[model samples]
Each structure stands twice: as structure tokens, then as C-alpha cells.
Target: MVDLLRKSEAFISQLSLVAIVDDQIVGYILFSKIYIVDDQGNRTPSIALAPVAVLPQFQKQGIGTQLIERGLSDARVLNFKSAVVLGHPTYYPKFGFVKAEKWSIKAPFDVPSEAFMAIELVENTLQGIAGTVEYPKEFQEVS
Candidate 1:
């Protein structure tokens, strides 16, 4: 993950939000650059929430929620239009992610429709956006 981030440094922007307990990192979430190609083949800028990890001991705490909520809020402030995530279907909805298929959005790789999700950070941000979600090329290497 770190290597991908390093290689994507040129085109990707990342927000690493950490949950610290007693001054030690206990949970982390990474939001990185992503895009959806239009019918015209133009790329619409977007973001993807990936590689979220919480220490085993921290699981089931609200740390993950805090990390996602805070990161999404910050992304909204930064004018990010939307975010895509491949994650647990049951867990991500709490953060406003719905099935990406609802928006005619899909991932480059085959995934369960329920496990791949998206959220519009700004009102009507995705009104006209529809296409396959493309992550940084670096992702394909690790994925």
C-alpha cells in the first residue's frame, strides 16, 4: 500500500486519517485519487476510499466510523465530488455508500455489486456521472 501511494504521488492526492489511542496509531483510512470515464472518454475526477485498516484490538470500536466520517467530511470540504469503495456491504452503508450499480458505476474488476459502493459528497454531484470507476494504475498491481 505504501509503495502504491509513493508511485501515485504524482497524480494522486491522499488523506491519511489516523485514530490514535495513547499516542499510538490504532486505526487508519486512506482516500486516494480515482476517476470515472464518461461516454466521451473524458475522465471525471473522483476519489476512492481504500485500504482502511484498524488494529485487531480496535475492531468493533467506533474508530473505523470516525475515520470514515472525518475523512469524508474533509473530502467534501476539499470539493471532492464523490468517493468509491470496495468493502463490506453491510459496513459501508453507515457512511452513506450505496451500491455503485445504482448510479451506473462499476469497478474495473469484477466484484459483488453489494461490495462495491459509492457516495456523492456534494448534493447532486453524481447527477450526470456514470461509468467504470478506475483507480490509479498502481492499484491493479496490488489488487
Candidate 2:
């Protein structure tokens, strides 16, 4: 998935981040551009936090949490309105993610509501936003 995004989404590189220790990559996270398409076909821009990973040796060491915190901080600096993620219902909430359904936002595929979450980078950025998230074609290819 990272390879696919690298090949197709130019800006993805800017949002792609990694954790390094002892001159080795230990973790990674990517924040890719996605959209929320409303009934009238209006597409509101957003980010998708996906494909986050930490080497087995790095697990339980806070590397994933650091990656997520840094990624979200970068996205906010980029002026992104919000971000969506299909992740642990318990884990993501630590970073302020709540069920997308709270704002009428949804995933393109069926997912447990608690697992599909969204976070507002800018205060109230998603207040009135409502639609189904449209991930890039690369995601479809993998799925």
C-alpha cells in the first residue's frame, strides 16, 4: 500500500513519516489525501491515516503513538480540515478520534462503527461535514 501511494500520490511523500533509531527504520505512518463526497457530489477534502506500522521489536514502546502524534501534527500544519482512520476503537480515541458517525461521516465499505473514526485537526473542522469517505484507487486495488 505504501508503494502504491508513493507511485501515485506526489504529496504523499510529504506526509509519509518514519521513526528511526540506531540508523534503522522502526516505524512508519502515512497520511494520504481522501475525500468526503456529499449527496450533491461536493467533495470535502480530508486526510486518511492508514498503514501505520511498527516493527515487532518496537511494539509496546510508544513508537506507533509517536508516529501518529507526529503525523497528525504535520497534517494540522498542512491545513487539512480533518482525518479519518479505520483503527482500533480503543487505541485511536487516545488521539482524539471519535466515531465518524458522530458527524454523519461514513466509510466506503462496511466497518464496525466504532472502528471507523475521524478526528478534527482544526477546531470544528468537521462540524457540518457529512458524507462517505472516498479513498484513492490504490486502496481499492489492495482491498
What are the per-residue Cα lDDT tens digits for candidate 2 across 1-143?
Answer: 77888887624676899999999999999988999999889999998998899999889999999999999988888888899999999999999999999999999999999999999999998888899998988888886
Local accuracy by lDDT, each model:
0.86, 0.91
- Candidate 2 residues lying further than 4 Å off, grouped into runs, are none
Q: What is the lDDT of candidate 1?
A: 0.86
Each prediction's RMSD over C-alphas, in Å, is 1.7, 1.1
TM-scores for all candidates?
A: 0.92, 0.96
Model 2, residue pairs in steric clash: none
| Candidate number achieving the greatest lDDT relative to the actual structure | 2
Q: How far is candidate 1 from the true structure (C-alpha RMSD, Å)?
A: 1.7
Top candidate, metric TM-score: 2
Count the clashes in each prediction: 0, 0
